[model samples]
Target: MTQTLEQIASCISGYDPNALPVAQAQEFIARLVPKVQAVERVAIRSALGRVLARDLISGIDVPSHDNSAMDGFALRGMDLADDGPTLLAVAGTGLAGQQFTGPVPPGHCVRIMTGAVMPDGLDTVIPQEFTTLNAEGLVSVPAGIVRTGDNRRLRGEDLARGDAALHAGRLLRPADLGLLASLGQAEVAVFRRLRVAFFSTGDELRSIGEPLGEGEVYDSNRYTIWAMLTRLGVDVLDLGVVRDDPQALREAFTRAAACADAVITSGGVSVGEADHTKRIMAELGEVLFWKIAMRPGRPMAIGKICEPGNAGREAILFGLPGNPVAVMVTFYAFVRDALLAMSGATAEALPPLQAVCTTGLRKKAGRTEYQRGIVSRGPDGRWQVEITGSQGSGILRSMSQANGLVVLHHGQGHVAAGDLVEVLPFDGLT
Candidate 1:
């Protein structure tokens, strides 16, 4: 059974929309989103960045036969002399594909190249550089050089038959493709790509190449949202900008919810904004407006939006703030992981790195702050970070200049120079 927003909120120990903490908000969103159930089978080459639908099992053992790991001489371990050099006759040469069939004498060795099948009687290998070939048809093995079974690869060492090679919910990477090929798997079952519809609101917003008269600005939130969604491999539907009119906002919301699995809108979620986006959101579905305890991104709305006249069609809604920096900060903080979970992929949290702060920062004790920072290696070869100047929510240039965000927890207060803080780098965070 599908749970309503009230039912989900009732399960939490302390559910307060007015003063929600970052961790609590994350948990609430995680619980609210549902995974997409659609799956598709595609070739291994086309499965990159898609979540696996089931575990992939190996059908055959890797390295089916015992082989030589290096270019060396294959010999029996019992024939090595402990006190002095032992001489042996060269029986035959063993190439990679061509095996040496022999019934050699007791004191004999086979010259083998890398990846060549080991002879039936040989139990050890001495690297080619560790031995000397005399003028006669014999090789000299020095004492105390190698032990028994030194450089021979065992069969089924990498992957045994019927073993699980990859698990479900794994986002396939380039290396996973190679592993699939090694298992002789030509096609794989993966979750379908998530579909998301997003748009920005406000009468002051204008599209690119349009005239910005008096108090109008180009719509930047759409482009940024599109870029972020593209990095996650989701199919995006750009709905352009919706004006503050009630009818237009309603039509936009209804259309977006009808077509996409999730709907994202930026602007008009604040307390006293002159717009109908927030009203339309509430009128269309069960939405919860939040004032989360965080810096740069405080006002947000989250819930499920249902299309008008179509009760079966619904989409998850994430109403973000209007500022340029707040949209990005909130998206990375909340929406990214939520969408990954909805796509049926494992949403692994981005690990934070601890770095020394080079300057002091003033922070409140009750709110978590995400300060734009430039993290670098100090002169002492330790990780250190410095904040970018002017961290206002409207200033996006500081974010562009920063490579990371200094995450100060809700309980933390003032920070001085040389203090250690956690930073989330922008490397893998498109």
Candidate 2:
């Protein structure tokens, strides 16, 4: 049975919607979403960036035999003398893909190349660079240079037969595809792509190519959100912008929930704004309006939205703030990980990089702050960060000029010059 939003929140400690901490809000969202279960079989070549639906087991041992790791002479380790070099006759050469057909006596060695199978009864290899061929057919081996099992790659050393190679919920990368191909697997099962429908709200917003009237600006949140979602490898449905009217919001919310796994919107989530969007969200499903203890983004909504008169058909809803910079900060702080979880991918924690602050920053202790900053290596060979010109939430150009966000955590006060701080980089996330 599915649990209600209130019930889930009741299980958490200090579940305050109005003054929720950043960590607690993240925990709440992590528990709210469910992983997608639909699976499809596709060729390994086409499985990059898709989540694995099941565990992959190896059917055969890698290498299939003990092979040479370098071009050397394969021989018995005991044949070398204790104090000086030992000489042995060079038998037939052992090239890769062709076995040595001739038999060898106790004082004989085989000339071997890299990747060649180790001849029977030989357990060591002396690299060709470490030895020299004498005037006769004898190959000279140095004493105490190599021991038994030197430069030999044993069978099943990489991956053994019947061992689990990849686990479920793994986001397959290029290396994973190569591993699957090495195991002779041509096809793999992966979770189907996640569908996300997103749009912008407010009467002051206009789409691109449309003439803007007085007090109106083109919507930039949708483009930023779309770019972020595209990097996560999800199927995006661009719903465009919906007005602030009740009827328009109702139609947009209904259609988004009906066709997508999650619905995302910007604007009309704050307390002072019009309540049409909030009322419609509550009417459709259980919604929670949160004033999360974070900067640039404070007023936000998180809940499940259902199609009209159909409770069984619903999608997760994330109503973000209206400001351009706030939209991006909130999405990275909350929405990015939630969508990855819902897509059946394993949760990967991105460890923030610590850098020395170049200047002092004034901050309060109650709320978390994400300041756009340019992080680079200083002349002293240390990672240093400085905030972009203005830290206002509406200044989108500062965010574009930044390479990372200087994260000032809650319970932390003002920072002085040369203080170490955490930075969430934009390399992979952007």
Candidate 2 residue spans exceeding 4 A from truth:
none
Compared with the true structure, what per-residue lDDT tens digits does model 2 show for residues 1-430? 7778998899889899999989888999998987888999999988988999999999999878898998989998878788999898988799999877688789899999999988888888989999988899689888888988899999999999988999998989889999999999999999999999999999999999999999999999999999999988999999899998888999999999999999999999998898999999998888999999999999999999998878798799999999999999999999999998999988887779999999999999989999999999999999999999789899999999999999999999999999999999999572
Clashing pairs in 1: none
The superposed Cα distance between candidate 1 and the true structure at residue 34, in angstroms, equals 0.6
TM-score of each: 0.95, 0.96
Model 2: lDDT to the true structure: 0.92
lDDT of 1 by residue, 37-154 (tens): 9999999999998999999888998877788999999999999999999899999989999999886578999999999999998978899999998888589999999988899998
